[model samples]
Target: MKNKKILLAVCGSVSFYKAYEIISLLKSEGADVRVMLSDGALRFANLISFEALVQNRVLSSISEDWQSGLNHINYSKNDLIIIAPASANTINKIAHGVADNVFLQTILASTCPKLIAPAANNNMLENFTTKNSLEILSKNGYDICEPVSKILACGDLGKGALADPQIIVEMAKRTLNQDNFYKGKKVVVTGGATTEKIDDVRGITNFSSGKMAKALADAFYYAGAELTFISSNEFSAPYPIIKFSSSEELLNAINSQNLSQNDLLVMCAAVSDYKPKTKFNGKMKKSQNELNLELVLNTDILKSLNLNCKKIGFKMEMDRALAKQNAINMLNSKNLNAVCLNVLDEKIKFGSDQTKIDFITPNGEFDTGFDTKPNIAQKITELAKQI
Candidate 1:
């Protein structure tokens, strides 16, 4: 946040007081923050409060003096704009280009990135009009910190609370440093365990949770990469995702993506090794006797890709020696530039947040000791920098 200019626009809500803490934290992080209070904001806090915290004049209204008249224009040149405790009315106005006041006028005139944290009654928040307005703002490229669901001052349990201050600040830092490594690069990440349908009611799948892929996607996005995330997981991705359910569907998704030599592909998904040769049209009936099933090997998606992009694959082994062997086999047979190896264990089982990953490449092996998903992603990102 060092030397970054941030503009804070506070709207009316009980959570408005949190804005002071936000400003203080940003300032402590070496950021230069300028505050503006919406008309409704005065209901929760007066101008004197913010003035004392910021140690600068709180911009509430346009000054009559021509020299002071351009304060909005000058302050709007911030690197980022944060609107906390954004009411439903404020959201609508910002969405529709309503700039009747200095605060709105400054936002209207500035091209800096925006992050809005809305706080309102449940009814107002769930209103269809508010939903459409937020969608419009998002489509227009505004970053939103979605309101949390909690007991409001009105005694309703629903979404309307302001996001935590730490989250807002972290997002600010991420937005400000978006020009890090991998900026303007194209990245493709595959996640989750693909299933093979056995019958109408059941299928075969692994225990993958897609957490690793999500972590890598987040890191790549923060680094400014244009990412295409293909996943079979039921969890929502941080960014827009191209979803698939089965191995065939995942393979098709991979085939459909436009990949090139400059692109980076992380094949982290656990695609099914085999699929039932014939799927039952209806739910398979239970029987007292054992049932015989025929199966066929599924296509190897990594080897099937014809692109010249750099590729990474994952191999889960039951033992350390087998892991090394399988890693080398995948690196050579699948034409992967690198392979990540993990030993299947009770503690480091699938879907676990902690993982001990070893990256094998032609140059050497890199071990990222037992670490969380985010730290593992950082290690992978550092390797991406070298590549």
Candidate 2:
């Protein structure tokens, strides 16, 4: 652990005092630690405290003198970067690529893994703006540690407490070790909502956050797989990813690749089923509120791959009764080794961190209760090993 360099960014919150404890914990674990504090964070906890705890310079702004030319670039060069007690404003800034401050600048410059433990008022954390920002950050490959429900500093009881220091430290360690699993084998993951274009600027799409696909890719990487992630526009993956925007583009990407029988293909993309029959050369002019549009069915990429190679497919459904039956039918029809079935009714299918899935095979079905997407991917990979 001592060989692992960790850059800790402290943000403003009543829980900012706990940041010192985190520093001490990480140091005890023998991790090389550097500390950066946000301007608002310094109000709750002074820079002197962090310097004493980590025995390193505490950076607060870009103007701070350092041995390196740009502290942000230097700070970004670490194995892992974590922001504990992340304020709503801080998260927003990071999501938007705002580099006005040292913390945001370092985050923007960072290629290393990032983890954010939010610590703010429950209302603030739950606000639509904050949630959207977090979604964007997660889609961009940031690990979010959800705050615990506890008594607030303002005397309110709800979810907004910083996660336990131990939990945060362990998560950081796991993230750093993610590369160890990808030593061999080939893995492929598809992500994002593939557009079935209706016109020059319009199309049909689904609400695929690409989190599940990203998680699957991350898991395969950690499980010793040479990873090739094919995604649309979503970008929450922390690996070399290939991008595509349409169903045809995705199909072409898959078909053009030289895939082997030993390779594992996880079809997690929510591709559109149909496209417009007539594509306008330019943006369609607005006339009547109601207009008829001719549609054509898009190629089923997963089904096509299923016929030629062994693959894992995903089925997102709302009805439980239909899910198992549909999963089994799809598995057999598509010649899949296994299918992961999930329900969108509980909001587990998209735009959320936690999810529940049922793993289905021809012989039996296994219920994997609600869990983090990473853990679910782990379970899926383990199950794949059995087959």
Candidate 3:
């Protein structure tokens, strides 16, 4: 990690003082640190103090040194850039690509992964515009370190305080170590089943409990990827989650973002393959005799994600031959990196806590015998590292 360079950008916020502690903590962890401050940041902290602490010059503006032709581009080349106490205004600028200041300019020019810790007044943080901007930034692959809820300097008690410096340092360390194999990668995981609404509350869905998807998300997160867990309303993960209720909604959410080469899309959702052709305005009444429901094909999430980004799909089969064939077919048909095949005969899938999986990649196939979800997740992360 010492070989990796880190750029710490400070913005104008009462939490600016905490940024100093962050710099020292990162330096202690063997990272080469450089400091960049927004013009407003200097009001709270002095450049001299930053320089003395990092033993490097504090960069404030493009005009600070004409000898350096483009400071923003040079600073942007670091391995990981973090903006501690990122003001609401600065966060908005970053989301919209408004490079009005040196900090924003460097962020715009940066190709490395970014982590932002936003600190603002409670009202500003909860504002609709700020919320939308944060969503945009998240979709664009930014790791948002959630702020803590505490008494604000403005005499309000709510969210918007900078997270603990220790947490910030840990996140920065993870982001700096690209050789750790999965650092800074964005992974979109689809989990659970989409509910096709029949009425205001009634719907048709599946039995998928999203356990596999949640496992995958947790594994990917531990592997250092900025994960987006896209799931149906029935599924929930212990990490950052994005929920959807229908196939159309899930499709729209996936299509709304621009995924790059480094991004990995995991289509683990057991989406409903069929849905009612027509939804009823009210709940269907009890049937007197045998009733038939017409079903229509729902959107194929795996195929769509395959077209969008590098994808990993899952197939559950009852027969070994069919499982292998389906895995190979998915690899060829969808151009996936790999397919995780599960045989349902073991009864260790779906809502089960344990699973046995056969991994079929472009190079070969391997099986991980009945194991706990955590172990399965570890194996998946290992495979991802190889990729």
Candidate 4:
């Protein structure tokens, strides 16, 4: 990560102090570092401390230096932008393209890859509105360094804490170093089944173990693409994992990923098509009588995606001919570059280790034959490189 230009954008939060440590770490690693603070962040962060550690003046909302007028515009030339301890206000503003302050204005002007590490109270992290804002940021191609679950400044213990400076730096290094075909490529992968809530405890879902999604993510990572893996399953991987539970949540996850015209989106998740019209906050008591549940169409993620990227959709059907047609229709309807079709059968169980799939691209369809998930993933990775 040496010889790299990095801008450390600090936001208002108890975790503002972490920015100093990050600056120190990045500088020691031979990176040219600059610091900027938001209005709220200035209250918690001592600008002098950052200047002393980074050997440069800190830029803030009231900055009047020679470059103050064109700071945001000129700073767009930097290689990377990182928002440490990103406050709810800053995240919300940036997600919606609000550039009122120096920090946000600079971000809007820069076309470089941005990494965001959010810090706030547990309630704020869990808030539906805040969650949606974060999603929007992702869809705009911002890399979200999700907060970890920990005891925050408040007494409540949950997610809303800034990650360790060491971990943040490591992620930054990975983001900046891309030497393969996937170099600078933004690849978003969605996997697993989305659950529809009937009550607080019960819901409906599809059969998906997310094994194939994991395989595909690993392939993308090894190929050197900036990978964002969204899953409905619980597991650990080397890449950043964004997990969602419902169809709406999955849509938000997909929408939030930072995808560019050169990026690739692989839609492999088994999302629900419908959900209960009304859901009880608390568990409903079981009665002896027959109960009918009202269902509504869930948002179609593929239809909702608005990013300019190479898109691949997945379709599964029992009949081979129907599956081919389904894949072609999905490809044409969504303006996707390719579609992966699977013929389901007794041997191809939900969690099966092997299955047959076809790659239906604009050039035509190519069958991979019956193969293991890993093998299929490798094939998919190669196909992605071609497009």
For each of the candidates, the C-alpha root-mean-square deviation to the true structure, in angstroms, is: 7.4, 15.1, 10.3, 12.5
Candidate 1 per-residue C-alpha lDDT over 1-387 given as tens digits, one digit per residue, 9 for 90 to 100: 777888899998889988988998999989988788888887678878887887767777633133664367887888999999789999999899999987788889999888888889978978998999999998897878888899998999998888888768766765775755676678889999988989978998888899998888777766667777898875544455899989888888887878788779989898888989999998888875899889999888887776788998989898876779888988899887888888877779877999988888977889999999987986887786655
Q: What is the lDDT of residue 207 in candidate 3?
A: 80
The alpha-carbon lDDT assigned to residue 252 of candidate 1 equals 84
For model 2, residues 153-192, the per-residue Cα lDDT tens digits are 9988989999988768766765676544344556788888
Model 4 misplacement above 4 A: 1-179
Clashes of 2: 4
Candidate 2 residue spans exceeding 4 A from truth = 1-182, 236-238, 306-309, 347-349
lDDT values for all models: 0.83, 0.81, 0.80, 0.83
Top model number, TM-score: 1
Cα lDDT tens digits for candidate 3, 162-256: 99888787666545433356666788888888889876677888788888888887677757777788887453333467788898888888876
Superposed by TM-score, candidate 1 places the C-alpha of residue 335 at a distance from the truth, in angstroms, of 1.2
Candidate 2 has which clashing residue pairs, if any? 139-236, 181-222, 181-224, 182-224
Model 1, runs deviating above 4 Å: 1-7, 11-36, 43-81, 84-173
Error of 2 at 374 (Å): 1.9
- Whole-model lDDT, candidate 1? 0.83
The C-alpha local distance difference test score for the whole of candidate 4 amounts to 0.83
**Using Cα atoms with residue i matched to residue i, what is each candidate's TM-score against the true structure?**
0.67, 0.57, 0.58, 0.55
Backbone collisions counted per model = 0, 4, 0, 6
